[model samples]
Target: MSSISDHPLRYKLANELHARPFPSMKAPCSAAYVAIKQPEDAVSRDRAQDLAHLTALLDRHGAPHPQPGATHYYGQIGKYWLKWEQHTEFVTYTAFSDGVVARPFDPAEFDVFPSDWLENAPGQRMTSILLNIVPRPAEDVAVTGSLDEWFVSESLAASEVLDGAAIMAGDFRIDLNGHLRFAVFAGAQTGARRIGRIVQRLCEIETYKTMSMLGFARVRALQPGLNELDTKLTGLMGTMSDERASAEETLHDLLSISAELETLSARSSFRFGATGAYEALVDQRIAALREERFQGRQQFGEFMMRRYAPAMRTVHSAEARLEAMSSRSIRASNLLRTRVDVERSAQNQTLLESMDKRSDLQLRLQRTVEGLSVVAISYYAVSLVGYLLYPLTQATGMSKGMLTALATVPVVLLVWWLVRRLRKSVE
Candidate 1:
């Protein structure tokens, strides 16, 4: 009987009954389905149909009929009343109210009457009628609870307990305000042939307002999440810059110290003299100084070269590559400085070497000129001596001019040979 019962009235009853907080309050012969919805809504249309079906059934059967203007039905079967508020619906019955007011419904309400009471009672299946009263609304419905002996009335409204066959097929809770809530869901359809038909319609509600409320709350609280991240990144950048500058300063200091030590090396070695112990002590001091300078300078240089320079280069490159930048001037200045420093250092080295070469060449030229002067002076002196000695040679029968010429020849020849040998040595 339960398997075959798929009437619209039955479905509507089941949905409404499932939504009931107390099954014991269910009217014996009366059931109602109310849909609280705005006009022009599909839910409202469905509600109207449900009302009409129950109304018709109540009129046909001897059930508690509706009183004058209200949507109440009272008859021999049962009594039912349904009301629709703004976007909310309520269904109530004498049996449901009573059961909720007292406790769980007596099993006798679902059982057959005794033979003695059947004299005036109609012959009917108690389970069948009771099942019929269990309206199976075509809508998905969730019961708040079943009012039992142990359950409290206040708990009924608060508790989300539910029942009925496939009662919560698609129902969900709508958290309106503190504990007070309502069940919201789409409609459902019947058996095998209705398989392809959708049992519920999906509603794409605008939940942005709900989400916005949460966002607003969070913003008001001023959670440190976003702010903390920004602070952390800024602090990290500052720490990096500080470390780089410190390293560069340390490296510069070490290089200066090394240059000073190298300048003092000659003086220090002289002070040690030829004494082995003193020399060893001097050597030890020089080595210690060198090691200290080497380690300090190398470490600083390595740190800057490997990390700072690359980071600086990357920052500048990225800045230049950017079509637009918030801080372009600063990056460009650092880049310009780096190029200028390299160029100036090269120029200084070249100038020093040029001066050294000029001094060397000037000394060599002076030495060559001095040797030439000596040769010229010696030739003049030898010529004069030869002239005076020519008279002494007159007794040997040689002419004075001839003897002088011969003396001049030997003198010129000897001077030329000596000059050639001097030039060769000098070259």
Candidate 2:
């Protein structure tokens, strides 16, 4: 064999694809499905708590424990088959049992999950569903009658799916028992796996639909605040063109608005992204059903398009508006900052010119002062020389006045030369 080593995650990654296998379920059965999620910060929640919660349920049924750190589990729990799956932000529990109860979509069937166990769940229920799977009757008229009786006539969405392998119906409404209901009728020759897939798709549709609506709720709550911010930003932008307005102050206000918008975006980004993903999953599952109209009732896809599509569009609109506002604010802020800098530059240039003029005047005045100093120093030196030459004149019969005049010219010249030398040395 070659000596090349395998990547550490190679085996683990390959096994993950088959981790959650589809349940093989037969007709004439019932399933109770529940999805739970923590109210906040669910994605980063401690996995140990979730494991402990699963272990508690398993212990109640005397079921064998799943492997350590398992993300999904399928095992028999008493008379029912329990499937538990841990997701990024939620966990789902589905219990399947053979045969439906006496009452159609009876709430009592949900008791497969003990009341105390549900009460002690790590998180609140995001959604709970009661699914009834039964063999299709010989006639379509009988199925119509059952659909009418089981679900509301106005909202009932019934469809023949998988090329008549099954017919499914649901009103997508919560009943008095606080559970969404779905009824599936499998064809006589339909395989168990096909029936199982249909059931799973129904469950997924309900779960994902509910999850996507959360984004709608968040957007609805954000609308008023968004409006207020929009108005404030508009007013602030108007001030940009006002020459009297302080650019620095306007920039500060713009930054504050930008910060608020970013905060809102940060808060809502996860929900919006998750909603898009969940909506896509819902659409995929419905399409996989290959639904066609049954008894002139709306198909699942049609119902979602009519009712669910509008809310998703609203969420998209809000997200778009937020981004646009943020961009506009940033552009305005940059423009204001540039304007402020330009104005400061101009002021600095004018101030520098004024300083240069003052320096020129000071230099001229210093030159005049230096000339007077040289003349004064020469006068003092000539006087002192005259007094010393008075004595010489007496001894040599020479005039004192002539000596003083001669000394004066030389002294002034020497003083001027000395001052020039000192100035050059300093320079």
Candidate 3:
């Protein structure tokens, strides 16, 4: 029997699907999460730096290092379980512990990561969070009171998700310690895996939300330039109809605009695309929670709709506007190029006509000069013949006047025929 060949990446690709397994944990746990991203060109930043940073943290705990070039890792670090993941534009470190500290959502809880290790990170912190997982209170009043004390009521989103398996609340705001806060109240009957899924979704939502906002920030920065370009493009288009404007000049301006737009597009393409992908993840993670309103408070979906989604929409609008402007500039450039070509063609045609007229005048002048030359040559020939024939006329007793007159006609005829033959040969 012949054996079937397998693709080289078949197993590797399949395993990659499950590489980042959700962390399984029970209630009464706390997590410190931080996402680090380079301030500039994060997507293309050195991935080795991310790994080295992770190694530094692991070395501090005397834990074994991850395999070379590993994009993700999960292992015990002292009392905490550390989960590390390297994403396209950022790296995430999450440390989970079995129990909370004395204070709820305290800044010290995030001290699980050594200050020196964090200070030596390869990139800036895009986001950092303090997350707490606790058992749900027996009464709704107690839950509301705790949420009121812990979060800002106006921006807070509290939701009972997974059919009341858990209630999650967050104000979506950074606290005095420069960290976002989220709390989860899982039912006693909630399985560890379900609780893990809930926690995973929360972290994902926050991370993606922050990432997506980067696109909004880009749009805000691009607004003034976009407006200026729009105005310039409009003016240049109007110049196309102005007879006084040179087509070449208009085309030059148009090309400049097109090039600028292309540069903007090139710079923004990855960011906008990544932002879109991150936004979708945020939406999917929130939706996967199967949220229901908690005690008539806002749900995660509502909060996003009110606060998060508009920024995403603005990003979309900016992308659309940029594309429109680029398309407009391209069309305008093409039209201007055609107009310039037509103008040049017309100028060349006029030049060709002028050259033809000059050529015709030169030919006429040359023919006139040729005619005068033949006449002048005949006069000399006749004079030379008369001198030679004067002796012959005396010897033959012919009249001198008659001799000269007869010879003149023959000599002039001969000279005219010679000149005609030479002109024909030259022609």
Error of 3 at 408 (Å): 4.4
Superposed on all Cα atoms, model 3 deviates from the true structure by an RMSD in Å of 2.4
- What TM-score would candidate 2 get against the native? 0.94
Model 1 clash number? 22
- Candidate with best lDDT: 3
Candidate 1 TM-score over all chains jointly: 0.19
Candidates, ranked, TM-score: 2, 3, 1
Estimate, for each residue in 384-411, the C-alpha lDDT of model 2 and write its tens digit.
Answer: 8788778888787769887888788888
Least well predicted 10-residue stretch by lDDT in candidate 1: 197-206
- Which residue pairs collide in model 3, if any? none
Q: Write the per-residue lDDT of candidate 1 for residues 155-175, one digit (tens) a residue.
A: 221111112112211112222
- Whichever of 1 and 2 has more lDDT, that candidate is 2
- Which runs in model 3 stand beyond 4 Å of their true positions? 41-43, 377-427
Query: In model 3, which range of ten residues has the least summed lDDT?
Result: 37-46
- For candidate 1, the per-residue lDDT at 226 reads 29
For candidate 3, report its TM-score: 0.92
